[model samples]
Target: MLIEVEDDFRSSSDKAYEKIFDMILTGQLKPGEKLIRRKLAEKTGVSTIPVMEALLRLEALGIVESIPYRGSRVVPITKEKVRDWYALREAIECQVMRIITRTLTEDEIADLEKLANKLDAMEQAGDTEGEEFWELHFEMHMIMARKTGHQSLIDSLHRINLFRLLQRAQYSATEHKNQIPKDNHHCLIDALRTRDPLIAEEVMREHIYHSDSMI
Candidate 1:
Protein backbone atom coordinates (compact mmCIF):
# COMPACT_ATOMS: atom_id res chain seq x y z
CA MET A 1 0.00 0.00 0.00
CA LEU A 2 1.20 3.46 -0.78
CA ILE A 3 1.02 5.19 2.54
CA GLU A 4 -0.21 8.73 2.30
CA VAL A 5 1.44 11.21 4.57
CA GLU A 6 -0.68 12.76 7.28
CA ASP A 7 -1.50 16.31 6.44
CA ASP A 8 -1.15 17.59 9.99
CA PHE A 9 2.04 16.10 11.24
CA ARG A 10 5.65 16.43 10.25
CA SER A 11 4.29 16.51 6.75
CA SER A 12 2.78 19.76 7.91
CA SER A 13 6.25 20.97 8.58
CA ASP A 14 7.40 19.73 5.24
CA LYS A 15 4.45 21.38 3.61
CA ALA A 16 5.21 24.56 5.46
CA TYR A 17 8.79 24.28 4.33
CA GLU A 18 7.80 23.91 0.72
CA LYS A 19 5.48 26.89 0.90
CA ILE A 20 8.15 29.02 2.53
CA PHE A 21 10.70 27.81 0.05
CA ASP A 22 8.50 28.83 -2.86
CA MET A 23 7.78 32.19 -1.29
CA ILE A 24 11.49 32.78 -1.25
CA LEU A 25 11.88 31.38 -4.71
CA THR A 26 9.05 33.43 -6.24
CA GLY A 27 10.14 36.64 -4.58
CA GLN A 28 7.06 36.76 -2.37
CA LEU A 29 9.26 36.68 0.68
CA LYS A 30 11.73 39.43 0.09
CA PRO A 31 15.11 39.42 1.73
CA GLY A 32 15.17 40.10 5.49
CA GLU A 33 11.45 39.54 5.99
CA LYS A 34 10.91 38.30 9.47
CA LEU A 35 9.32 34.87 9.77
CA ILE A 36 7.34 35.20 12.94
CA ARG A 37 6.43 31.93 14.66
CA ARG A 38 2.75 32.49 15.23
CA LYS A 39 2.27 34.27 11.93
CA LEU A 40 4.07 31.55 10.01
CA ALA A 41 2.06 28.87 11.75
CA GLU A 42 -1.16 30.66 10.95
CA LYS A 43 -0.10 31.45 7.45
CA THR A 44 1.11 27.95 6.65
CA GLY A 45 -1.83 26.35 8.48
CA VAL A 46 0.64 24.28 10.44
CA SER A 47 1.54 24.29 14.12
CA THR A 48 4.29 26.43 15.51
CA ILE A 49 6.56 23.44 15.95
CA PRO A 50 6.21 22.52 12.31
CA VAL A 51 6.86 26.12 11.28
CA MET A 52 10.01 26.13 13.39
CA GLU A 53 11.05 22.85 11.81
CA ALA A 54 10.54 24.37 8.41
CA LEU A 55 12.59 27.43 9.32
CA LEU A 56 15.35 25.21 10.68
CA ARG A 57 15.58 23.47 7.36
CA LEU A 58 15.72 26.82 5.54
CA GLU A 59 18.52 27.92 7.86
CA ALA A 60 20.43 24.76 7.03
CA LEU A 61 19.94 25.59 3.38
CA GLY A 62 21.51 29.02 4.09
CA ILE A 63 18.35 30.82 3.10
CA VAL A 64 17.09 31.67 6.56
CA GLU A 65 18.56 33.18 9.72
CA SER A 66 17.23 33.00 13.24
CA ILE A 67 16.89 35.95 15.59
CA PRO A 68 17.17 35.53 19.35
CA TYR A 69 13.77 35.02 21.02
CA ARG A 70 12.12 36.84 18.15
CA GLY A 71 12.00 34.80 14.96
CA SER A 72 13.84 33.86 11.81
CA ARG A 73 14.24 36.01 8.72
CA VAL A 74 15.22 35.50 5.14
CA VAL A 75 18.85 36.34 4.56
CA PRO A 76 19.59 39.49 2.63
CA ILE A 77 21.32 39.34 -0.70
CA THR A 78 25.03 40.05 -0.87
CA LYS A 79 27.23 40.80 -3.85
CA GLU A 80 29.80 38.38 -2.47
CA LYS A 81 27.34 35.54 -3.08
CA VAL A 82 26.93 36.66 -6.66
CA ARG A 83 30.70 36.84 -7.15
CA ASP A 84 31.38 33.51 -5.49
CA TRP A 85 28.67 31.64 -7.40
CA TYR A 86 29.81 33.11 -10.71
CA ALA A 87 33.32 31.72 -10.17
CA LEU A 88 32.04 28.35 -8.98
CA ARG A 89 29.48 28.00 -11.74
CA GLU A 90 31.93 28.97 -14.44
CA ALA A 91 34.33 26.21 -13.44
CA ILE A 92 31.66 23.51 -13.10
CA GLU A 93 29.68 24.43 -16.20
CA CYS A 94 32.75 24.62 -18.42
CA GLN A 95 33.73 21.04 -17.64
CA VAL A 96 30.13 19.89 -17.94
CA MET A 97 29.83 21.43 -21.39
CA ARG A 98 32.98 19.66 -22.49
CA ILE A 99 31.62 16.36 -21.28
CA ILE A 100 28.27 16.93 -22.92
CA THR A 101 29.76 17.81 -26.26
CA ARG A 102 32.05 14.80 -26.24
CA THR A 103 29.45 12.09 -25.64
CA LEU A 104 25.81 13.24 -25.56
CA THR A 105 23.83 11.38 -28.19
CA GLU A 106 21.67 13.03 -30.81
CA ASP A 107 18.53 11.86 -29.02
CA GLU A 108 19.75 13.49 -25.79
CA ILE A 109 20.23 16.79 -27.52
CA ALA A 110 16.75 16.47 -29.01
CA ASP A 111 15.33 15.95 -25.55
CA LEU A 112 17.09 19.06 -24.36
CA GLU A 113 15.64 21.04 -27.23
CA LYS A 114 12.23 19.81 -26.22
CA LEU A 115 12.87 21.01 -22.71
CA ALA A 116 14.01 24.34 -24.08
CA ASN A 117 10.80 24.71 -26.00
CA LYS A 118 8.83 24.15 -22.84
CA LEU A 119 10.88 26.80 -21.12
CA ASP A 120 10.37 29.17 -24.01
CA ALA A 121 6.64 28.72 -23.77
CA MET A 122 6.82 29.43 -20.08
CA GLU A 123 8.86 32.52 -20.65
CA GLN A 124 6.57 33.76 -23.38
CA ALA A 125 3.38 33.01 -21.56
CA GLY A 126 4.82 34.75 -18.51
CA ASP A 127 4.11 31.68 -16.42
CA THR A 128 7.37 31.97 -14.56
CA GLU A 129 5.44 32.53 -11.36
CA GLY A 130 7.81 30.78 -8.96
CA GLU A 131 9.92 27.73 -9.57
CA GLU A 132 8.11 27.17 -12.86
CA PHE A 133 11.23 27.86 -14.86
CA TRP A 134 13.63 26.38 -12.35
CA GLU A 135 12.94 22.67 -12.81
CA LEU A 136 13.37 22.85 -16.56
CA HIS A 137 16.30 25.23 -16.42
CA PHE A 138 18.09 23.22 -13.79
CA GLU A 139 17.46 20.00 -15.67
CA MET A 140 18.95 21.54 -18.79
CA HIS A 141 22.14 22.19 -16.87
CA MET A 142 21.96 18.83 -15.12
CA ILE A 143 21.51 16.91 -18.37
CA MET A 144 24.77 18.35 -19.61
CA ALA A 145 26.55 17.78 -16.33
CA ARG A 146 25.33 14.22 -15.96
CA LYS A 147 26.83 13.35 -19.31
CA THR A 148 30.24 13.74 -17.70
CA GLY A 149 29.77 10.24 -16.21
CA HIS A 150 31.40 11.60 -13.08
CA GLN A 151 29.01 10.71 -10.32
CA SER A 152 31.01 12.48 -7.63
CA LEU A 153 31.13 15.73 -9.54
CA ILE A 154 27.47 15.46 -10.38
CA ASP A 155 26.63 14.85 -6.73
CA SER A 156 28.69 17.78 -5.58
CA LEU A 157 27.01 20.01 -8.13
CA HIS A 158 23.62 18.90 -6.90
CA ARG A 159 24.57 20.12 -3.42
CA ILE A 160 25.77 23.35 -4.91
CA ASN A 161 22.52 23.84 -6.81
CA LEU A 162 20.76 25.26 -3.77
CA PHE A 163 23.06 28.24 -3.67
CA ARG A 164 23.07 28.53 -7.41
CA LEU A 165 19.31 28.71 -7.44
CA LEU A 166 19.41 31.19 -4.59
CA GLN A 167 21.81 33.47 -6.37
CA ARG A 168 19.94 33.29 -9.65
CA ALA A 169 16.58 33.77 -8.00
CA GLN A 170 17.87 36.63 -5.90
CA TYR A 171 19.30 38.24 -8.99
CA SER A 172 16.08 37.88 -10.86
CA ALA A 173 14.01 39.16 -7.98
CA THR A 174 16.04 41.71 -6.05
CA GLU A 175 18.52 43.02 -8.56
CA HIS A 176 17.40 42.73 -12.16
CA LYS A 177 16.67 46.02 -13.87
CA ASN A 178 16.11 44.78 -17.40
CA GLN A 179 14.83 41.91 -19.45
CA ILE A 180 16.93 38.79 -20.02
CA PRO A 181 17.99 38.52 -23.62
CA LYS A 182 15.42 36.40 -25.40
CA ASP A 183 17.83 34.63 -27.72
CA ASN A 184 20.59 33.61 -25.36
CA HIS A 185 18.99 30.30 -24.40
CA HIS A 186 18.32 29.37 -27.98
CA CYS A 187 21.86 30.30 -28.92
CA LEU A 188 23.22 28.12 -26.14
CA ILE A 189 21.38 25.08 -27.46
CA ASP A 190 22.49 25.94 -30.95
CA ALA A 191 26.10 25.85 -29.88
CA LEU A 192 25.59 22.53 -28.18
CA ARG A 193 23.76 21.04 -31.15
CA THR A 194 26.63 22.00 -33.39
CA ARG A 195 28.96 20.04 -31.11
CA ASP A 196 30.91 23.17 -30.29
CA PRO A 197 31.83 22.89 -26.64
CA LEU A 198 34.00 25.97 -26.83
CA ILE A 199 31.13 28.20 -27.84
CA ALA A 200 28.82 26.33 -25.54
CA GLU A 201 31.11 26.96 -22.59
CA GLU A 202 31.57 30.54 -23.58
CA VAL A 203 27.85 31.16 -23.87
CA MET A 204 27.14 29.56 -20.51
CA ARG A 205 29.88 31.59 -18.87
CA GLU A 206 28.61 34.71 -20.53
CA HIS A 207 25.12 34.07 -19.26
CA ILE A 208 26.39 33.62 -15.73
CA TYR A 209 28.54 36.68 -15.98
CA HIS A 210 25.67 38.67 -17.38
CA SER A 211 23.55 37.55 -14.49
CA ASP A 212 26.35 38.62 -12.17
CA SER A 213 26.40 42.10 -13.66
CA MET A 214 22.66 42.44 -13.19
CA ILE A 215 22.98 41.27 -9.61
Candidate 2:
Protein backbone atom coordinates (compact mmCIF):
# COMPACT_ATOMS: atom_id res chain seq x y z
CA MET A 1 0.00 0.00 0.00
CA LEU A 2 2.82 2.37 0.83
CA ILE A 3 4.59 1.55 -2.46
CA GLU A 4 1.42 2.27 -4.43
CA VAL A 5 1.00 5.58 -2.64
CA GLU A 6 4.60 6.50 -3.40
CA ASP A 7 4.13 5.69 -7.05
CA ASP A 8 1.05 7.89 -7.23
CA PHE A 9 2.98 10.76 -5.67
CA ARG A 10 5.80 10.31 -8.15
CA SER A 11 3.38 10.24 -11.07
CA SER A 12 1.76 13.45 -9.92
CA SER A 13 5.15 15.07 -9.54
CA ASP A 14 6.17 14.05 -13.04
CA LYS A 15 2.97 15.50 -14.46
CA ALA A 16 3.56 18.75 -12.59
CA TYR A 17 7.10 18.91 -13.88
CA GLU A 18 5.97 18.43 -17.48
CA LYS A 19 3.25 21.04 -17.16
CA ILE A 20 5.65 23.57 -15.68
CA PHE A 21 8.30 22.76 -18.22
CA ASP A 22 5.86 23.21 -21.09
CA MET A 23 4.71 26.51 -19.65
CA ILE A 24 8.28 27.78 -19.59
CA LEU A 25 9.13 26.46 -23.03
CA THR A 26 6.00 27.95 -24.49
CA GLY A 27 6.99 31.34 -23.03
CA GLN A 28 4.01 31.46 -20.69
CA LEU A 29 6.53 31.56 -17.86
CA LYS A 30 9.13 34.13 -18.73
CA PRO A 31 12.66 34.24 -17.40
CA GLY A 32 12.98 35.26 -13.73
CA GLU A 33 9.26 34.88 -13.19
CA LYS A 34 8.47 34.03 -9.59
CA LEU A 35 6.93 30.58 -9.14
CA ILE A 36 4.29 30.23 -6.46
CA ARG A 37 3.95 26.59 -5.47
CA ARG A 38 0.32 26.73 -4.50
CA LYS A 39 -0.60 28.61 -7.66
CA LEU A 40 1.33 26.09 -9.76
CA ALA A 41 -0.30 23.17 -7.97
CA GLU A 42 -3.69 24.70 -8.66
CA LYS A 43 -2.77 25.29 -12.30
CA THR A 44 -1.51 21.76 -12.77
CA GLY A 45 -4.42 20.24 -10.84
CA VAL A 46 -2.03 18.55 -8.41
CA SER A 47 -1.25 18.97 -4.74
CA THR A 48 1.43 21.26 -3.35
CA ILE A 49 3.68 18.28 -2.61
CA PRO A 50 3.91 17.38 -6.29
CA VAL A 51 4.48 20.99 -7.32
CA MET A 52 7.31 21.23 -4.76
CA GLU A 53 8.86 18.05 -6.07
CA ALA A 54 8.61 19.31 -9.63
CA LEU A 55 10.29 22.60 -8.75
CA LEU A 56 13.10 20.72 -6.99
CA ARG A 57 13.72 18.69 -10.12
CA LEU A 58 13.73 21.82 -12.29
CA GLU A 59 16.10 23.48 -9.80
CA ALA A 60 18.45 20.54 -10.12
CA LEU A 61 18.32 20.95 -13.90
CA GLY A 62 19.32 24.65 -13.58
CA ILE A 63 16.00 25.77 -15.04
CA VAL A 64 14.73 27.12 -11.71
CA GLU A 65 16.47 28.69 -8.73
CA SER A 66 15.28 28.95 -5.12
CA ILE A 67 15.84 32.20 -3.28
CA PRO A 68 16.41 32.32 0.47
CA TYR A 69 12.96 32.39 2.17
CA ARG A 70 11.50 33.96 -0.98
CA GLY A 71 10.61 30.90 -3.05
CA SER A 72 11.72 30.01 -6.60
CA ARG A 73 11.84 31.70 -9.99
CA VAL A 74 12.85 30.87 -13.52
CA VAL A 75 16.54 31.36 -14.16
CA PRO A 76 17.22 34.83 -15.52
CA ILE A 77 18.36 35.24 -19.11
CA THR A 78 21.24 37.60 -19.68
CA LYS A 79 23.54 38.37 -22.58
CA GLU A 80 26.60 37.38 -20.53
CA LYS A 81 25.02 34.08 -19.58
CA VAL A 82 23.96 33.43 -23.16
CA ARG A 83 27.50 34.08 -24.34
CA ASP A 84 28.88 31.75 -21.70
CA TRP A 85 26.35 29.08 -22.69
CA TYR A 86 27.33 29.44 -26.36
CA ALA A 87 31.01 29.16 -25.49
CA LEU A 88 30.52 26.03 -23.41
CA ARG A 89 28.12 24.60 -25.95
CA GLU A 90 30.62 25.20 -28.75
CA ALA A 91 33.41 23.58 -26.76
CA ILE A 92 31.33 20.53 -25.92
CA GLU A 93 29.38 20.13 -29.16
CA CYS A 94 32.34 20.77 -31.45
CA GLN A 95 34.06 17.90 -29.69
CA VAL A 96 30.85 15.91 -30.12
CA MET A 97 30.94 16.48 -33.88
CA ARG A 98 34.62 15.54 -33.99
CA ILE A 99 33.93 12.29 -32.17
CA ILE A 100 30.85 11.52 -34.23
CA THR A 101 32.71 12.09 -37.48
CA ARG A 102 35.23 9.39 -36.59
CA THR A 103 32.82 6.93 -34.96
CA LEU A 104 29.34 7.31 -36.43
CA THR A 105 28.17 4.34 -38.42
CA GLU A 106 26.62 4.71 -41.85
CA ASP A 107 23.26 3.67 -40.45
CA GLU A 108 23.55 6.27 -37.72
CA ILE A 109 24.44 8.90 -40.26
CA ALA A 110 21.36 7.98 -42.29
CA ASP A 111 19.21 8.21 -39.20
CA LEU A 112 20.57 11.65 -38.42
CA GLU A 113 20.04 12.71 -42.00
CA LYS A 114 16.43 11.64 -41.78
CA LEU A 115 15.87 13.61 -38.60
CA ALA A 116 17.55 16.67 -40.09
CA ASN A 117 15.34 16.43 -43.13
CA LYS A 118 12.27 16.30 -40.94
CA LEU A 119 13.44 19.41 -39.07
CA ASP A 120 14.02 21.19 -42.36
CA ALA A 121 10.54 20.31 -43.50
CA MET A 122 9.10 21.62 -40.27
CA GLU A 123 11.05 24.85 -40.54
CA GLN A 124 10.03 25.29 -44.13
CA ALA A 125 6.45 24.79 -43.07
CA GLY A 126 6.92 27.63 -40.58
CA ASP A 127 6.45 25.60 -37.43
CA THR A 128 9.56 26.71 -35.58
CA GLU A 129 7.67 28.11 -32.59
CA GLY A 130 5.83 24.90 -31.85
CA GLU A 131 6.86 22.59 -29.01
CA GLU A 132 7.25 19.60 -31.30
CA PHE A 133 9.81 21.42 -33.41
CA TRP A 134 11.88 22.39 -30.36
CA GLU A 135 11.74 18.86 -28.99
CA LEU A 136 12.94 17.44 -32.27
CA HIS A 137 15.66 20.06 -32.50
CA PHE A 138 16.97 19.01 -29.09
CA GLU A 139 16.67 15.36 -30.01
CA MET A 140 18.75 15.99 -33.13
CA HIS A 141 21.72 17.21 -31.09
CA MET A 142 21.26 14.57 -28.38
CA ILE A 143 21.39 11.85 -31.02
CA MET A 144 24.87 13.09 -31.96
CA ALA A 145 26.03 13.05 -28.33
CA ARG A 146 24.66 9.54 -27.87
CA LYS A 147 26.60 8.37 -30.90
CA THR A 148 29.81 9.17 -29.05
CA GLY A 149 28.85 6.83 -26.16
CA HIS A 150 29.99 9.46 -23.64
CA GLN A 151 27.56 9.72 -20.76
CA SER A 152 29.26 12.84 -19.37
CA LEU A 153 28.98 14.59 -22.70
CA ILE A 154 25.36 13.56 -23.02
CA ASP A 155 24.54 14.79 -19.50
CA SER A 156 26.24 18.13 -20.08
CA LEU A 157 24.40 18.63 -23.35
CA HIS A 158 21.13 17.72 -21.67
CA ARG A 159 21.54 20.49 -19.09
CA ILE A 160 22.79 22.97 -21.68
CA ASN A 161 19.78 22.17 -23.86
CA LEU A 162 17.26 23.19 -21.21
CA PHE A 163 18.90 26.61 -21.09
CA ARG A 164 18.98 26.74 -24.86
CA LEU A 165 15.22 26.32 -24.94
CA LEU A 166 14.84 29.08 -22.39
CA GLN A 167 17.06 31.32 -24.47
CA ARG A 168 14.98 30.64 -27.56
CA ALA A 169 11.79 31.39 -25.69
CA GLN A 170 13.24 34.67 -24.43
CA TYR A 171 14.38 35.56 -27.91
CA SER A 172 10.97 34.90 -29.35
CA ALA A 173 9.42 37.14 -26.71
CA THR A 174 11.55 39.98 -28.04
CA GLU A 175 11.36 41.94 -31.28
CA HIS A 176 14.20 40.19 -33.09
CA LYS A 177 13.02 38.90 -36.47
CA ASN A 178 16.00 36.89 -37.61
CA GLN A 179 15.02 33.48 -38.84
CA ILE A 180 17.31 30.46 -38.60
CA PRO A 181 18.51 29.50 -42.05
CA LYS A 182 16.46 26.69 -43.50
CA ASP A 183 19.52 24.73 -44.59
CA ASN A 184 21.24 24.94 -41.24
CA HIS A 185 21.04 21.30 -40.16
CA HIS A 186 21.46 20.09 -43.71
CA CYS A 187 24.77 21.89 -43.95
CA LEU A 188 25.97 20.45 -40.65
CA ILE A 189 25.02 16.94 -41.70
CA ASP A 190 26.92 17.38 -44.94
CA ALA A 191 30.04 18.42 -43.04
CA LEU A 192 29.73 15.49 -40.67
CA ARG A 193 29.47 13.09 -43.59
CA THR A 194 32.92 14.24 -44.68
CA ARG A 195 34.34 12.15 -41.83
CA ASP A 196 36.89 14.89 -41.14
CA PRO A 197 36.94 16.08 -37.56
CA LEU A 198 38.36 19.50 -38.41
CA ILE A 199 35.72 20.10 -41.06
CA ALA A 200 32.94 18.94 -38.76
CA GLU A 201 34.19 21.16 -35.94
CA GLU A 202 34.38 24.19 -38.23
CA VAL A 203 30.80 23.68 -39.43
CA MET A 204 29.52 23.06 -35.92
CA ARG A 205 31.19 26.22 -34.62
CA GLU A 206 29.55 28.28 -37.33
CA HIS A 207 26.21 26.70 -36.57
CA ILE A 208 26.48 27.44 -32.84
CA TYR A 209 27.62 31.02 -33.39
CA HIS A 210 24.79 31.76 -35.79
CA SER A 211 22.38 32.15 -32.88
CA ASP A 212 24.37 35.07 -31.45
CA SER A 213 22.46 37.58 -33.56
CA MET A 214 19.12 36.44 -32.16
CA ILE A 215 19.76 37.56 -28.57
Candidate 3:
Protein backbone atom coordinates (compact mmCIF):
# COMPACT_ATOMS: atom_id res chain seq x y z
CA MET A 1 0.00 0.00 0.00
CA LEU A 2 1.22 3.53 0.81
CA ILE A 3 4.54 3.12 2.59
CA GLU A 4 5.16 6.85 2.64
CA VAL A 5 4.97 7.36 6.35
CA GLU A 6 6.85 10.43 7.57
CA ASP A 7 7.88 8.33 10.50
CA ASP A 8 7.70 4.54 10.54
CA PHE A 9 4.16 4.20 11.75
CA ARG A 10 4.28 0.46 11.09
CA SER A 11 6.20 -1.93 13.30
CA SER A 12 8.22 -4.85 11.96
CA SER A 13 5.31 -7.14 12.64
CA ASP A 14 2.91 -4.75 11.00
CA LYS A 15 5.06 -4.59 7.88
CA ALA A 16 5.24 -8.36 7.73
CA TYR A 17 1.50 -8.55 8.24
CA GLU A 18 0.79 -6.16 5.41
CA LYS A 19 3.16 -7.97 3.03
CA ILE A 20 1.59 -11.34 3.68
CA PHE A 21 -1.87 -9.82 3.54
CA ASP A 22 -1.08 -8.29 0.15
CA MET A 23 0.01 -11.65 -1.22
CA ILE A 24 -3.06 -13.39 0.15
CA LEU A 25 -5.47 -10.76 -1.16
CA THR A 26 -3.92 -10.77 -4.64
CA GLY A 27 -4.11 -14.57 -4.87
CA GLN A 28 -0.31 -14.69 -5.02
CA LEU A 29 0.10 -16.71 -1.86
CA LYS A 30 -3.00 -18.60 -3.14
CA PRO A 31 -5.88 -19.76 -0.99
CA GLY A 32 -5.15 -22.73 1.27
CA GLU A 33 -1.42 -22.52 0.72
CA LYS A 34 0.51 -23.30 3.88
CA LEU A 35 2.36 -20.42 5.49
CA ILE A 36 5.75 -21.50 6.77
CA ARG A 37 6.97 -18.72 8.99
CA ARG A 38 10.64 -19.53 8.51
CA LYS A 39 10.36 -19.61 4.73
CA LEU A 40 8.30 -16.47 4.79
CA ALA A 41 10.89 -14.76 6.95
CA GLU A 42 13.65 -15.59 4.48
CA LYS A 43 11.56 -14.60 1.51
CA THR A 44 10.53 -11.31 3.00
CA GLY A 45 13.90 -10.62 4.62
CA VAL A 46 12.40 -10.45 8.08
CA SER A 47 12.59 -12.61 11.17
CA THR A 48 10.43 -15.59 11.94
CA ILE A 49 9.14 -13.89 15.07
CA PRO A 50 7.65 -11.05 13.05
CA VAL A 51 6.18 -13.51 10.54
CA MET A 52 4.56 -15.35 13.40
CA GLU A 53 3.20 -12.08 14.72
CA ALA A 54 1.85 -11.22 11.26
CA LEU A 55 0.20 -14.61 10.83
CA LEU A 56 -1.58 -14.20 14.14
CA ARG A 57 -2.99 -10.88 13.03
CA LEU A 58 -4.03 -12.38 9.71
CA GLU A 59 -5.80 -15.20 11.49
CA ALA A 60 -7.79 -12.68 13.48
CA LEU A 61 -8.73 -10.90 10.25
CA GLY A 62 -9.89 -14.21 8.71
CA ILE A 63 -7.30 -13.96 5.97
CA VAL A 64 -5.24 -16.78 7.44
CA GLU A 65 -6.02 -19.73 9.68
CA SER A 66 -4.22 -22.45 11.58
CA ILE A 67 -5.17 -26.10 11.11
CA PRO A 68 -4.25 -27.10 14.69
CA TYR A 69 -1.92 -29.94 13.65
CA ARG A 70 -1.06 -28.46 10.24
CA GLY A 71 0.18 -24.99 11.05
CA SER A 72 -1.41 -22.02 9.24
CA ARG A 73 -2.43 -21.22 5.67
CA VAL A 74 -4.30 -18.68 3.64
CA VAL A 75 -8.05 -19.11 3.91
CA PRO A 76 -9.71 -20.59 0.85
CA ILE A 77 -12.15 -18.31 -0.91
CA THR A 78 -15.51 -19.99 -1.10
CA LYS A 79 -18.40 -19.10 -3.40
CA GLU A 80 -20.70 -18.57 -0.46
CA LYS A 81 -18.27 -16.27 1.28
CA VAL A 82 -17.86 -14.18 -1.85
CA ARG A 83 -21.60 -13.85 -2.20
CA ASP A 84 -22.01 -12.78 1.41
CA TRP A 85 -19.26 -10.17 1.24
CA TYR A 86 -20.71 -8.80 -1.95
CA ALA A 87 -24.14 -8.54 -0.41
CA LEU A 88 -22.71 -6.44 2.43
CA ARG A 89 -20.43 -4.38 0.20
CA GLU A 90 -23.08 -3.67 -2.39
CA ALA A 91 -25.55 -2.47 0.18
CA ILE A 92 -23.04 -0.10 1.77
CA GLU A 93 -21.52 1.18 -1.49
CA CYS A 94 -24.85 1.78 -3.21
CA GLN A 95 -25.99 3.89 -0.30
CA VAL A 96 -22.77 5.87 -0.41
CA MET A 97 -23.09 6.51 -4.15
CA ARG A 98 -26.65 7.69 -3.67
CA ILE A 99 -25.48 10.24 -1.13
CA ILE A 100 -22.48 11.25 -3.22
CA THR A 101 -24.63 11.92 -6.27
CA ARG A 102 -26.60 14.49 -4.33
CA THR A 103 -23.60 16.33 -2.89
CA LEU A 104 -20.50 15.90 -5.12
CA THR A 105 -18.87 19.01 -6.53
CA GLU A 106 -17.25 19.65 -9.93
CA ASP A 107 -13.75 19.28 -8.48
CA GLU A 108 -14.56 15.90 -6.98
CA ILE A 109 -15.91 14.72 -10.31
CA ALA A 110 -12.66 15.73 -12.03
CA ASP A 111 -10.59 13.83 -9.45
CA LEU A 112 -12.63 10.67 -10.01
CA GLU A 113 -12.31 10.99 -13.79
CA LYS A 114 -8.55 11.21 -13.37
CA LEU A 115 -8.45 8.07 -11.26
CA ALA A 116 -10.54 6.12 -13.80
CA ASN A 117 -8.41 7.31 -16.67
CA LYS A 118 -5.30 6.19 -14.84
CA LEU A 119 -6.75 2.70 -14.44
CA ASP A 120 -7.57 2.65 -18.17
CA ALA A 121 -4.08 3.73 -19.07
CA MET A 122 -2.56 1.04 -16.87
CA GLU A 123 -4.72 -1.65 -18.49
CA GLN A 124 -4.09 -0.43 -22.04
CA ALA A 125 -0.34 -0.68 -21.49
CA GLY A 126 -0.72 -4.50 -21.35
CA ASP A 127 0.95 -4.55 -17.96
CA THR A 128 -1.96 -6.44 -16.43
CA GLU A 129 -0.74 -4.90 -13.17
CA GLY A 130 -3.94 -5.86 -11.47
CA GLU A 131 -2.57 -5.26 -7.99
CA GLU A 132 -1.79 -1.62 -8.74
CA PHE A 133 -5.09 -1.12 -10.49
CA TRP A 134 -6.96 -2.86 -7.71
CA GLU A 135 -5.59 -0.58 -4.97
CA LEU A 136 -6.22 2.62 -6.87
CA HIS A 137 -9.67 1.50 -7.94
CA PHE A 138 -10.51 0.62 -4.37
CA GLU A 139 -9.35 4.05 -3.23
CA MET A 140 -11.54 5.71 -5.84
CA HIS A 141 -14.60 3.90 -4.50
CA MET A 142 -13.66 4.79 -0.92
CA ILE A 143 -13.21 8.42 -1.94
CA MET A 144 -16.73 8.40 -3.32
CA ALA A 145 -18.05 6.91 -0.11
CA ARG A 146 -16.12 9.38 2.01
CA LYS A 147 -17.43 12.32 0.04
CA THR A 148 -20.91 11.36 1.25
CA GLY A 149 -20.01 12.90 4.64
CA HIS A 150 -20.72 9.80 6.66
CA GLN A 151 -17.91 8.67 8.94
CA SER A 152 -19.67 5.46 9.88
CA LEU A 153 -20.04 4.34 6.27
CA ILE A 154 -16.44 5.33 5.53
CA ASP A 155 -15.26 3.29 8.50
CA SER A 156 -17.28 0.29 7.37
CA LEU A 157 -15.92 0.57 3.82
CA HIS A 158 -12.36 0.69 5.17
CA ARG A 159 -12.76 -2.66 6.89
CA ILE A 160 -14.03 -4.33 3.69
CA ASN A 161 -11.69 -2.67 1.18
CA LEU A 162 -9.12 -5.43 0.98
CA PHE A 163 -11.74 -8.17 0.72
CA ARG A 164 -13.62 -6.34 -2.00
CA LEU A 165 -10.43 -5.70 -3.95
CA LEU A 166 -9.64 -9.39 -3.80
CA GLN A 167 -12.98 -10.11 -5.43
CA ARG A 168 -12.66 -7.28 -7.95
CA ALA A 169 -9.24 -8.45 -9.11
CA GLN A 170 -10.85 -11.68 -10.25
CA TYR A 171 -12.48 -9.67 -13.04
CA SER A 172 -9.14 -9.13 -14.76
CA ALA A 173 -8.97 -10.74 -18.23
CA THR A 174 -12.29 -12.44 -17.63
CA GLU A 175 -14.43 -13.42 -20.65
CA HIS A 176 -15.73 -9.85 -20.90
CA LYS A 177 -13.78 -7.23 -18.91
CA ASN A 178 -13.53 -5.05 -21.97
CA GLN A 179 -14.75 -1.55 -21.24
CA ILE A 180 -16.54 -2.67 -18.12
CA PRO A 181 -14.12 -0.75 -15.92
CA LYS A 182 -14.07 2.29 -18.19
CA ASP A 183 -17.79 2.13 -18.87
CA ASN A 184 -18.66 1.68 -15.21
CA HIS A 185 -16.60 4.71 -14.32
CA HIS A 186 -18.20 6.71 -17.09
CA CYS A 187 -21.71 5.79 -15.98
CA LEU A 188 -20.86 6.59 -12.36
CA ILE A 189 -19.47 9.98 -13.40
CA ASP A 190 -22.56 10.72 -15.45
CA ALA A 191 -24.82 9.92 -12.53
CA LEU A 192 -22.81 12.16 -10.26
CA ARG A 193 -22.81 14.95 -12.82
CA THR A 194 -26.57 14.76 -13.24
CA ARG A 195 -27.02 14.57 -9.47
CA ASP A 196 -29.19 11.52 -10.04
CA PRO A 197 -29.08 9.35 -6.93
CA LEU A 198 -31.20 6.63 -8.56
CA ILE A 199 -28.91 6.31 -11.55
CA ALA A 200 -25.74 6.45 -9.50
CA GLU A 201 -26.89 3.78 -7.12
CA GLU A 202 -28.19 1.61 -9.93
CA VAL A 203 -25.00 1.85 -11.98
CA MET A 204 -22.81 1.17 -8.94
CA ARG A 205 -24.91 -1.79 -7.92
CA GLU A 206 -24.77 -3.29 -11.39
CA HIS A 207 -21.04 -2.70 -11.69
CA ILE A 208 -20.31 -4.34 -8.35
CA TYR A 209 -22.55 -7.29 -9.25
CA HIS A 210 -20.78 -7.85 -12.55
CA SER A 211 -17.38 -7.71 -10.89
CA ASP A 212 -18.47 -10.00 -8.08
CA SER A 213 -19.70 -12.62 -10.55
CA MET A 214 -16.28 -12.68 -12.15
CA ILE A 215 -14.84 -13.74 -8.81
Best by lDDT: 2
Which candidate leads the pack in TM-score? 2
| lDDT (Cα, 0-100) at 53 in candidate 3 | 85
Q: Which parts of model 1 are misplaced by more than 4 Å?
A: 1-9, 26-28, 67-71, 117-136, 146-183, 193-200
* TM per prediction: 0.66, 0.81, 0.73
lDDT of 2 by residue, 29-90 (tens): 98999999999998999999999999998898788999999999999999899888888889
TM-score of 2: 0.81
In TM-score terms, candidate 1 sits at 0.66
Q: Write the per-residue lDDT of candidate 3 for residues 1-215, one digit (tens) a residue.
A: 62211244548887788788777765678876999999899877789998998899777656678998999998766788778778888999999988988887899899898887776666555444546776787788888888988888886676577555555434345455554554555667777788888888898898788767566
RMSD of each: 5.6, 5.0, 3.8
lDDT for model 2, please: 0.84
Candidate 3 regions exceeding 4 Å error are: 2-10, 22-28, 38-49, 67-71, 117-132, 149-152, 164-172, 178-182
Q: In candidate 1, where is summed lDDT lowest over 10 consecutive residues?
A: 1-10
